[model samples]
Target chain A: MPAETTRAANRERLAARRAAEAAARAQAERRRRTVLGGVVAAVAVLVALVAVIVVQTHRTSTSANAAVPANTVDGTVISVGSADAPVTVDLYEDFQCPNCKAFEDASGRTVAQLVADGTVQAHYHGMAFLDTSANGRYSTRALNAAAVVVATAGPGAFQAFHDLLFANQPVEGGSGLTDAQLVQYATQAGAAGSSVEHDIRNLTYGDWVKTATDQASKDGVTATPTVFVDGHKLADLSSAGLTSAVTAAAAG
Target chain B: MRWNAATAGPWLGTAARLVLGGVFVVAGALKVPDPGAAVRAVRAYRLLPESLVAPVAFGLPVIEIAVGLALLLGVFVRTASIAAAVLLVVFLVGVGSAWARGLRIDCGCFGNGGEVTAGETAYPLEVLRDAALVVVALLLARWPASRLALGGRSVAGTTDRKEYSRAR
Candidate 1:
């Protein structure tokens, strides 16, 4: 073959190889994009999810802080009856616990009777440890409102309000009673007013509730409605048993 | 990816995704409604820095939900699988630590975790469950070319071309 023919053949073969290489490169780029696009999308979504969670968590905590006044340092162990009563009846309870409500129903009146009779000085340690067991911070809100009533209206109003709370205890896994309902209950117990309503709504004693709950846990009171009579934890946890134990402690 | 596809690729991945994704979705959703409980549950573990507890409690559920949704949709199977594996590992550590420390508490994977009266802690079962999840996650991550994946394609062609280039 002539030199010209050989050169033409070489050019065609080189051009064909270059076209094949370009096609392969384009295909590779498309594949890489496809693979990477999914990962990038996932990362972006995950980042967005985290941002939302952070914002929400911040809102709840900040609102909690806002609810408690800076001046009020801590929630207290609200007590009732004569301070010099022979026996001390300590009750650890939560507003949101159904079992606590049951305990209150079974033995609350008896304890109240004891408190009224001046046989023992009853100390109620209401905690918000069950805050997560329900929706919308029901435990904290209820306990906080109870604290306000106890603080302002004294133990008599607290007993009335406490009974009303259990009487209308909302179901678990719900937003539970709203602020308005809480204020209404407080009012019925003769503890409601503008500032008092504000206290209930803002969760004025929320921090105290938290502190008290922490203290309870540290004190080894895990579950709700833990009754202690003269420093002894009631093991039976029954209404009759609780009353009888209190009576025994008082007698001694 | 293609090699795995030829076997039980998408089917296996889908099954794993469904089981893991379903459980995580339920677990996370149940907690989302009540962040406080989630925090308490984290506190019960007695692991993690105090400052980190709330963030983890809040973020873990969101992460679980996101990964679970991604897996259920089959959109980014590999990434979701990796996330699932990471989540399971963290859970295993928490459950293991709680067991080692003799903390009688619920694992808090779903709702109603944290402190219990007595005889309610189920650490070994929780750990075993998480271990199984980790295995499934790793398997799916290793072979993410499952059936009906959103953007799944065989990587065999790419693998072959590298060999072809090396030969050249």
Candidate 2:
């Protein structure tokens, strides 16, 4: 009888030990899960906060101290050609982008003809996202210079300067045209003035260039030489293609 | 120490941790400075709804950096690995979808990803790279013990025995 009682007591002790071990294991598991949950929660909060700050700062910086050129409609678009033309053409281009130059070369004459005939009103949006490619923020400098020409000398000088800049676009990853060269180009384009000279040299419109590029991106114009006819994106960017698209839009 | 499984397991984890963590950090850093380009890259995929594009583009880089730092510092290795694996799987799907759709777009894995010329897309390579990273991430999740971890106990020592056994 005594032996049996001892055996029963030993079994009870063993069961109690096992129960305590299970409880401890459960507690550890819970703590681990809590820590893991905490990690995820912390990451989510950090991401949200940082993303908001980034987007907010970008917006404020773009608009702060930004200069607006004359004949500009949407802060980014510089309108040229007839105000009441039958067709509206939006040309999104980057000063340092080789592709924009190629596009301009291929279709510049056709666009000029349309403008001359009062058939189309052209809106140019100069972008500066290629600042990294140019050695000295050339994309922004060139864009800012063009803006200065437009602001001081009018859209006519701006058009001439635009053509000249594309005509002599620097190679990618090189320092873009010098400030003196930009002033000379402005003069040749009939944009010569002390104000034009000073603005071009100092990048008075640099903030505007950044704002314009950001706006272009917001408007879904990420790539250079993106064309739109009467709010419709032109799939074929060739001269012939553009002519036909413009004619069709005018007719429609 | 002689080269053996016991000696190598933690070191191997450390190496994987650094390589994968470094990749995440660099990719995130490149994209962070250019949200417009990032948004454009996401748009090029044409998979997400218009409403979700901005949010995803803006948030993804930050997530990558956070997870990368966690892995790099060896803090919360298991949880961070799971997060990394999730991100890799998402990338795999995105690249795979773009490939299937015949869209000529860069995977935008690093930065400046947008519409490329028809000849510029490297969909297969992108998918392969993401798949491999996914494997590494999952492996890290399975065995979070690494030589340079910052938990209460040194993972490379006997302290991680319980975790290793539990993982097994």
Candidate 3:
């Protein structure tokens, strides 16, 4: 009987050791799998991040090299009105923005009046931040066309083209306008030369639009139709507000 | 024929995996097309430095897509789930900080995010959504076993609730 009991005890100890070894083996396998998974995830994330960075860098640099039109003041702004005007008004506007269109409707004449009276100099910095909203980048294309007008047809044509764009501003979240319509508008706005057509179709001034938009953001121009009167942000973007701001700045 | 954790957990995990996977993929895809807009949205947060914004804008969508694909394919569910939870927590913090700072901005969870009008900020809803997603992600992390998964058998077997008990 004692020998039988001893045999049973030995069997119990052997089974316990086997179970422990099995668990240990399972744990080691799990740890290996986890490490493998971690390696896979890390490699994927790193490769993806590097690829995006390279692509983004290429995109920005290519656009950065795009030629800035000769007429832009300091390589980004299109200056309108007398150079000696007492007040400086900087307008940051995106062609695809409805708010920008509304701002134009509200203060377009006031701006024209101020410019004509030689009381203010208007610097228009066109932005294409809304390019994503429209198919084929209406904001960038329209702004590029405006820049083309400035370069080929001078400030007068640019001013006319600018007004025409906002006046016929396409509804947001759709293709804003066709290149054909832009060309027609340019013609009606008195823009001449075949370069206007070539540039508008090819987005010759696309780089300038991107540069101007980036500059606007750096200059704290967050939203569209942002108006700065004598370097101060005009909070109220109304006709009266613009006029009063201009009058006060001119008075100073 | 009773529905219990062992019987029902995997199906629930599968549904969560698909939902989170779809959300991340769509979110990343929407922002990937317009990196500039994504950059602008990040800038609107006013949290990251100017230099870091572009890198974050470019890198984030890629990470989201990779993680999303991993989740959707059910390959490495635990790892993907943990990554997803981390991302959701980060978003929840971003939304919460924006709310606390009184900065009226969009969460930019999808594509069109930036400073919105004062009346347009949806901080509470964004925070709630992100927080809930974070919970779902953590739950998936805890129980990685989901039906129809491709490569999570070993990973899930280790943490699958009933499996753990049965194994013991």
Candidate 4:
């Protein structure tokens, strides 16, 4: 064999090896790109699904609270006793809460006596924070029923209806009083046979209860049976402890 | 590109993935029915933006279910594993922040979590659990090998086969 021919054949072998290596590298790169594209698509799909669910939930939950009228002090929120009473005690409660019932049973009489004497006016803030406890949102319904009384009857009738609800408070974690029971209680308290019964049955203030609960939460009232005087929470909710706090606030 | 022998052991990844996947499915399902509870739980954390609270409360469960299903099926294992890892890291941060702030909130991972008055908060245990899941996620991202994977291909050409077993 000639020396030049031998050298040319070696060069040809080297070139062929380089081309094969390049093709393999390109194939590997293509595979990497494919995997990247697939991963990106998968993640995007998951995000889109999440976005859809978010929009739907926001729509339903927000609309559920938007329709009801705000009924404030005159027609919305309930107030007991003289609006110009020297002292004001605010009570925040959830209808389904066991502790609220205990509070009502323990200190309710003292409050009523104070109201009778015109020494203190009470502002009852109804919340539906315990909506998750019952399958049908009984706390909201009960509060809305109470709202009916406040709207149709005067403060005197509302105070009577309030006692009736606590006297027959439902067991914690159970489905609370039905619409019929709420209406019956209102009638028994002499606060019914008017729009009060209609509102109780129709749950006209259901949205209001939810709004009130949200407002309470924003105001740092996470737990139930919270009692306040002049915007300061009373640590101790016992009848004696509350009376002292009220007396001190009134003196101040 | 190449085999992931540095943090190898596909068997461990498989075990971890299954356990974590099951955890997410259960957690998401529990929160699905009670969006109100979910909202309160998120609010209790006090970590999210006010506007984001409602969306996060409702959307998180759906994402968890999707990620759990993907992991269990082993479809898009690498992507799913990465997603799991990211999510676990986020949860770890959230739990750690809550613990640091001394916030008395249920993690709401399982359910019935909201503003608890008096209860033991297992924030340490919860953080530890999430950190462990994060490690599993990294393992799967590195070497996503497990039995019965639907796609059978992970990280391009790798799968739960002889090659994966020998990766260690």
Which of the numbered candidates is closest to the native, going by highest DockQ? Answer: 3
Residue ranges of candidate 3 with Cα displaced over 4 Å: A1-16, A63-65, A132-134, B74-79, B96-105, B112-125, B138-145, B150-168
Ranking by lDDT: 3, 2, 1, 4
Tell me the deviation in Å of residue B110 in model 1: 3.7
Which rank order by TM-score, best down to worst?
3, 2, 4, 1
Q: Could you list the iRMS of every candidate?
A: 3.9, 4.2, 3.1, 3.4
DockQ score for model 1, please? 0.28
Model 3, position A60, has a per-residue lDDT of: 62
Docking class of 4: acceptable
What is the C-alpha lDDT profile of model 1 across A1-252, one tens digit per residue? 699999999999999999999999988997798678767876876787778677757644633343432212234577778888888988888787887788888888888888878888888877775554345788889988988887778777887998899989887667788889999999999897798898988877776776677566555555666789999988776778977898899778
User: Could you tell which candidate, 1 or 3, scores higher by DockQ?
Assistant: 3
Q: Which ranges in model 4 have alpha carbons more than 4 Å from their true place?
A: A1-54, A57-71, A74-76, A117-119, A132-135, A194-197, B1-12, B29-38, B76-82, B92-104, B110-113, B117-143, B152-168
**lDDT minimum window of 10 residues, candidate 2 chain B:** B151-160
DockQ of each: 0.28, 0.21, 0.38, 0.28
Model 2 C-alpha lDDT per residue in residues B1-168, reported as the tens digit of each score: 567787798889999889889999899888877776677788777778877876787778878887888789877788889999999998999888878877667888898737442235788899989999999999999987777665422454555566653442
Output the better candidate (2/3) by TM-score. Answer: 3
- Spell out the clash pairs found in candidate 2: none
Worst 10 residues of 1 chain A by lDDT: A64-73
